[model samples]
Target: MAVAETQGIEPVDLAAGSEIDEYILDDGVFKGGMSTLRTATNSVDKKVMIKFFVQETSYQRELSSLYSLQKAESRNVISLIDYFEAEEEDEWFPQSVIVLELGTVSLQHWAHGKRPVSEVYLKSILLDILGGLESMYTAGLVHCDLKPGNIMQFTCPGREQGIWKLIDFDCACKYSAI
Candidate 1:
């Protein structure tokens, strides 16, 4: 990842040992964004990944989309395990509580800018993304942002390797309720 001069000091640190918010995440080559604190747990162990926000202006819309996605695409989308409003330790703290998820790594991390992702990996990712999009589509939702960082890789309870999972729905579609 290429990181440049930080205009503002990062308020949080998002690594394995502790949680943080308002930190600079310069990991993605496609985008530089904010890294927030999050926690994840599988059947065996719990881990954390610095959650990045590619779009901060629409955090509310994205968060709402996530709730809807979670209910319908639970099987395919990376789960947002927890979220809550943040309390100001100081008077200047940000108001929104951060969204958390179960998986942190993505397909790009696997491919490392290499295109023509292997047929097997490509097929697996497509299927999982389709499953997630189908659920959203059925709900009249659209995933406006379908890029590398948003698509994470994870091994669910019964799935094998290459079981790609979708995450980061800040640009997800909106559907009328039934």
Candidate 2:
């Protein structure tokens, strides 16, 4: 992987025990209101995605929300492998790195292509989305930013390709008590 200066700081190189390594920053593939997405390889040569939060507060909010979802252990939600705060001398605030499983593609990309998916696949994706939403609802969290980009496709064993999963909890929030 090539090294480049991002936001005036070098990409972080994670050490052992971090569950991931060779943390080289790649081109930003997806951009969201709270974070930028890049692809990376983990220790075992598995391809993963890293979400680099632009601000510390945004990082904290996302971490907290993910932690809640983690406790739920919902399969429909994105699986967070690990996260850490990168310590850098040149940076004012440490960068929070959230490692997630790399999806085959985002739903947005598929939809934008204007190709029609099989009805069975479409139903599967829809059910998966609702399942994820129900899990969030059970945890008392609301996924405020539900969109095609936030919904990803992955290949599941014993099933055809394009199994969809809901991702991105940066803007997710707890429901207000009534």
Candidate 3:
């Protein structure tokens, strides 16, 4: 579908527009981490998943990740398409927002990693993810949070299948020399 086409999904209304968007349905994502639903009304008619830096400990690194990925290639890494800060703040958390491609329902959703995703498919996902990481590493960045919640799956309407997208750069620190 054209990027200009608005996917029919509704935008996650941030009552206060902050780091934690209560407007997004809690059920939108598979995990407990903060989330925001991104509906494209003008392009790409579909639901875009957004993960937030709900925790304060790793927030700074997110900025670094965003900057590092800015220089990386498109397909290998989860590109940082755009970013915005919500002037509206929650009673408690700081106002912050980062846009990224939505990952899959959660690889471990089946049984806490017990029910493994297809080996062949999983390998393909990891390839893309690692390539991105390797590129980041070359650029002198360290993505500390390499857990399940941080990896999202990217699927397009025209594409026959989806690919794994490494996300949540909130914990990605610049440990290497630029």
Candidate 4:
């Protein structure tokens, strides 16, 4: 879908079957206040989520945090698969793109749909979130936004429960910056 320009940032004109690099865009598109998210598949047909940042500052903040967490290989944190800048014709600034692992649902939505979860399941979710926080601390970064909406759940085929992961580090910053 073609997203109209917002806040002086031109959106990437993508539709179903459109190709960006080796990733094929799907029909899914989610527009946010500062970014746009689309579902896509890579060369190997692995499902992924693509985020296009409207502001360079937000893009850089998220990129920095993702890079640090990527090196730590924290399972509790969302994995950053790849990133690049997609330049548009005559556009002074290029759109910053970030490829990430696809998540089934946000923690807020999941909790709202399902009734009270089992105690064990609740414990597991808390532990997973804590693990993500610990990983961030170890990397000398802090996630300024830690809400249910920023937490995602990844469904595992063999596992009884989905894995909870922390996501959206646009507001995150280094400890030294705090």
Against the true structure, what is each candidate's TM-score?
0.64, 0.80, 0.61, 0.87
Model 4 C-alpha lDDT per residue in residues 29-137, reported as the tens digit of each score: 8888789898999999899999989888999999999999988889899999999875675353368889999999999998896876889899999998998998998
Tens-place lDDT per residue, model 2, 1-178, is 2223233442343322232246554444566667767777766677788887877777777788878887887888888888878667635335677888888878898888666778977888899899889888877899888999889988789877657888888788899659
Using TM-score as the measure, which candidate wins?
4
Q: Between candidates 1 and 4, which one is better according to lDDT?
A: 4
Q: Give the candidates in order of lDDT, highest first.
A: 4, 2, 1, 3
Q: How does candidate 4 fare on TM-score?
A: 0.87
Across residues 1-178, which tens digit of lDDT does each residue of candidate 3 receive?
A: 1212212222343321222222232234333344444432113433344544454444446756667676766365576645555333432334355655555554445227455568976677678678867777776777776876566656756655566666666656777454
The alpha-carbon lDDT assigned to residue 25 of candidate 4 equals: 85
What ranges in model 4 sit over 4 Å off? 1-13, 86-93
Candidate 1 lDDT by residue in tens digits, 4-36: 221222434322322233322323222234335
lDDT of 1 at 126: 85
Residue 133 C-alpha lDDT in model 1? 72
Ranking by TM-score: 4, 2, 1, 3
Query: Between which residue pairs do clashes occur in model 2?
Result: none
Q: Candidate 2, TM-score vs. the true structure?
A: 0.80
Lowest summed lDDT over 10 consecutive residues: which window, candidate 4? Answer: 1-10
Q: What C-alpha RMSD separates each model from the true structure? A: 6.9, 4.6, 7.8, 3.9
Measured on C-alpha atoms, candidate 4 has an lDDT of 0.85
Q: What would the TM-score be for candidate 1 when compared with the true structure?
A: 0.64
Locate the minimum summed-lDDT window of 10 residues in model 3.
1-10
